[model samples]
Target: MILDVQGKAAYAYTGGKPFDASLPSTVFIHGAEHDHSVWALQTRYFAHHGFGVLAVDLPGHCRSAGPALRTVAAMADW
Candidate 1:
């Protein structure tokens, strides 16, 4: 799914029925050179536990559009 935060797009995934806002949201940030697909195992594990998990791509990588990894702040901004 797509979560548009502050007009900046954040891509994610959601399973099961409609998610409940009260439920916790888990954001997974991949390691260097990795993409959201890397978290496939974790995503499935968490979802099975009834948690809302979002494995997002880092900026400049995968579906995210931007410059290459430059700094910690830049990565956080992704």
Candidate 2:
């Protein structure tokens, strides 16, 4: 799924299901130069078992838009 965050498009893999914010959410953050695909199996498992998975591609990486964050703090803030 894609979300508009700070005016930019943020992409997240929903483990083949629509995201449900009301459900328990698990946000997966990848390492440098990585994207949501890194958590494929884990996200799928969680989503199928009742957790709302948000395996995200950080800004400027893969499907997400906007410039890449320059620091850990910046990424965290985003």
Candidate 3:
């Protein structure tokens, strides 16, 4: 799935299911230079167990658009 965050495109893998905001959500953030695919197994498990998984590709990483966040605070805010 893709979200508009701070006017930029943010990409998230939904673990093969449509996202449901009302369900429990888990946000997965990858390490430096990585993307959402890193959490493939875990996200799939969580989603199958009734969680709304959002394994995100940070800005400028993989499918996400815009400049990379320079600070931890900024990443958290996004």
Ten consecutive residues with minimal summed lDDT in candidate 2?
27-36
Q: Which lDDT values do the candidates have, in the order given?
A: 0.69, 0.91, 0.91
For residue 75, give model 1's deviation from the true position in Å: 0.9
TM-score per candidate, in order?
A: 0.72, 0.92, 0.90
Q: Which residue window of length 10 is worst by lDDT in model 1?
A: 12-21
Instruction: Give a tens-digit lDDT track for model 2, residues 1-78.
Output: 888889989999998888898999999999778999999999999999999999989999999998888899999888
lDDT of 3 by residue, 1-78 (tens): 989988888999999899899999999999777899999999999999999999999998999999888887878787
lDDT (Cα) of model 1: 0.69
Q: Candidate 1: misplaced stretches above 4 Å?
A: 15-19
**Residue 15 shift from truth in candidate 3, angstroms:** 0.7
Comparison by TM-score, 1 against 2, better one: 2
